[model samples]
Target: MKYDVAVLGAGMVGVCVAIHLLQQGRSVLLMDRNDAGEETSYGNAGLLQQEAVRPYEFPHEPSVLLPAAFNLRLDVRYHLTALPKLIQPLWSYFRHCSPRRYESIAQEYGHIINMTLACHQELISAAGAEQLIRKVGWISLYRTAKGRHKGLRTLDAYTRQGVNFKVLNGDELAEIEPAIKGHHAGGVHWQDPWIAGHPGQLVKAYTNLFKQLGGVFVQGDAGSLKRSHQQSWQLRDHQDTLLEVDEIVIALGPWSAEITARFGYRPPMFFKRGYHMHYQYPAGQPRLTRAVQDSEKGYMMTPMDAGLRICTGAELGLRDTPSTPVQIDRAEAIARKLIPLGERLDAEPWRGARPCIPDMKPIIGPLPGAPGLWCAFGHGHQGFTMGPATGKLLAAMMTGQTTDIDMSGFRAERFKKP
Candidate 1:
């Protein structure tokens, strides 16, 4: 059977893309090697992050870089073997972190970030996924007064861009999140973001909405995709053609490059590995009222249906590297100093990769050399938060409509002439 479009990832991004295309009068098939939302979409700190106006930058400071070089920090770790392959993209990432370039990039990124809530709100309303979302924004904790002052200043600058936030004294923070142990200074209560109590379930709800809207989702592989002489894209399983489509969108997240490489659009996409594990608080200790991120400690503690989840900082490891969960332990140790996170919920931590481009922006438009082929990936740490926005922009581009935001910055051809 032939379809108008097939999206090749069933994660939050692909599912939303299919939903949007279907809404725009396209017969779309959402394909993936695994179930929807069970991969990278499942693992996140669970914030919609409307206040994350700035793109995550690689630290150019010597004080931060020196310790991180030795893997001494809890927030970042790297795989020694991955460095050789990562040199080029990592270098570009560093270059883009320069103040002037990063500032310009953040302006463009904020255009997308600003739309995240409206986009996701539309999906949540359609899917009836309101129960999975907490409108109460997360809290950012700081230990030292100096850190709090600097952080508040940075946040104050963001406020001029129309972000909403509240400054909390140490006591106020303690009053709101009583379980957190000690804090000398204060924190920023980001009042604009939404927390996904269960990020994976939220994706499933959207997928269910896709099914209700008559969008097809199936198990398929892009590795088996090809353009027939008739100029149609076909997905295969084993020796049989699973389906054929006139157009295909590669939204395979971290694995996007592998397939795009075959089509001559391999972006300099590197992976940042992160881990999370749930823990039950001891009796009498209050559970997390809202998601809280300890900026100084480089971890996030969030409350969800499963339990209180402690998420680790970024690990600059190869995508294919075996799971190294050392960060979870370190994060848990750091968290216990503040809050009482009791027994571990899962024996093994959940790990996922964040697909990052050197310029700290996602690619979300047509594949240059490959006609009838589109691309959307490289959302980095904010994919979970911005998936719907990305989908909306891509679907509009795919259907030849004016997008909500400018599409030039996110084109797949930005890396090279491809």
Candidate 2:
């Protein structure tokens, strides 16, 4: 059957897009190679960050850059082979990290981030997935007084954008979370975000909601998407016609650029590969009430339904690079000392890429010169947090309605060369 629109990629972003379109009375066929949220959306720390106003930046300081360059730092790593392909976009990313440009990007980002919590809440309430979420926020553990001061300084910037956080002294921190023990100077408890027991299940809940609302889902290769002479978007699965639609949204997360480039829309994209693994605690071990991030250590231990999830920092490399889980190994060593992170639950670590663009903002809205073709990936680290907001915004843009936030700077054409 001919659908009104086809959304490629059934990750958090794409699923949300399909649901929003379906709610707007459009016949949406949600296509993905894997089940909804089974890919990058599955293996996150599971925090819906409302305080993520500032985009993650490249290290400008020589001390930070030098260690990261040699792969000495656990928070950041790079492959020697991936450097050549990434140099241009990485350089652009560096330039955007400049204080002036970063501030500008944050302003645009905050506009959308400000709407994320409410958007997700609306969907969660509708989907009856309230049991999947915990309103309790997360803690940022500072290992040193200097690190605490630096974290506060960074947090102060977010506070200007209305982010709420409470500073906890060593004694107060220990009192609140007795399970946590380390040489922590202090902690900043961000009181805005929500914790997900299972990040993938949350996506599935949303996807199920979409299905209940009459959205169609199919397994199809988004890379093979094409436009017919009649200006309709056609999707195929091994020569079997799956869908024909008036519009399509490419929300394939890390793989989004592969489809966008085919239509002459090449977003200067880079991938930040992150690792996470769950660990089983001993029988008598104290339970963590929430997720705790080692502020200086580039890792966070989140209490999930599965176990305490230890998530590592960014790895700059090709998407299909061999698993060099040095950060996971190093972060596990640090986590075991802080909390009771016993034996690993998984045989292998889960790795996924954050689809990052050079300018530190996601690409939304329609593609230039490719009418009826839209783009919705490049969310980087905040995809889960911002997916509903993106869905709401993109749906509005697609339907010619007013968006809740100003969506001028965020569009696929921004990356297109003049």
| Candidate 2 worst ten-residue window by lDDT | 234-243
lDDT of 1 by residue, 222-336 (tens): 7889897789987874336568799999999999999988987779999999999998868887877889888977889889888998888899989987998998998888788
Over 4 Å off, model 2: none
Instruction: List model 2 lDDT by residue over 304-409, tens digit each.
Output: 9998899888999998787888899999998888887689999999999999999989999999998999999999989999999999999999999999888989
Overlapping backbone residue pairs in candidate 1 total 1
lDDT of 1: 0.89
What's the lDDT of the predicted structure labeled candidate 2? 0.90
Candidate 1 wrongly placed segments (more than 4 Å): 237-241
Model 1 root-mean-square deviation:
1.3
